[model samples]
Target: MGEVTAVAQALPPWVLVVIAAAVGVKYLGQALAEGSEQWARILGPLGRRWRSRAERRTEKEAADLVALQRQVENLSVEVERLTARDKKRGEFEEKLREYLVYDANWHFRAQLAAAGAGTTLPDHMSFAQWEASRP
Candidate 1:
């Protein structure tokens, strides 16, 4: 008893607390060995909690991925539509330029005829007529 007291006095208070905790854990472990009902009862909830959290995280990630895929699909469709509209605008501009050139030539020939020149040219077609004449 005297030696035990001396040893206890030499150790720090924290060391004694650690020893007590270890003894308590050992007793509990002995009471619940592998495959024991008490072991499952004590640790099953912790295992289930961890598994449920993982499942929820996986489900949320899958949902976010699906949403991103849908957004990409929508953007792709919009890009296709805009590209087609841009192509049509280019065609319209080209047609407008052709008509301006034809009209200029027609006016120049008419002026020459009015000034008593001998050469003649075809009459200018209207905008709609010019468009209908081309493919």
Candidate 2:
């Protein structure tokens, strides 16, 4: 490769220009014989038509990305709302259970108090004896 470069550098600039022109002409002649298909194939994305097509594809992809992002955001909000509702429901259930326990305790104590009231002893032993003797 070094030897080739040295040989190329030794050549006159005009010789290089002529060689380049010949190559260009050869390709141009081939393109002309092959018609527009050859030109379109060689130009590929460099052509204006291909560029516009690429731009349209990019725009469509961007729009799709935006739509997907919006869907993700909406789903996140929905998840947060559901999580909050679940938390609130749990708190309410806990409070209801506490109230039920308190109500049960109150009712049990009332029953005990009522039973004790019925079995109350008289202040005087004579009164107690008379009450017991009557029944």
Can you give the lDDT of residue 117 in candidate 1? 70
The residue-by-residue lDDT of candidate 1 on 1-135, one tens digit each, is 999999999999999999999999765554453325455356567444444555677799999999999999999999999999999999999998999899788797687886677655666776789899999
Across 16-129, the per-residue lDDT of candidate 2 in tens digits comes to: 999999999766655543445446456654443554555577799999999999999999999999999999999999998899689767766766787788863333333347
Indicate the TM-score of model 1.
0.53
Name the weakest run of 10 consecutive residues (lDDT summed) in model 1: 31-40
Question: For model 2, what is the C-alpha lDDT against the true structure?
Answer: 0.73
The C-alpha stretches of model 1 lying farther than 4 A from their native spots are 1-43, 117-135
Model 2 spans > 4 angstroms off? 1-47, 119-135
Give TM-scores for every candidate, taking all chains together and pairing residue i with residue i: 0.53, 0.50
Candidate number of the best TM-score = 1
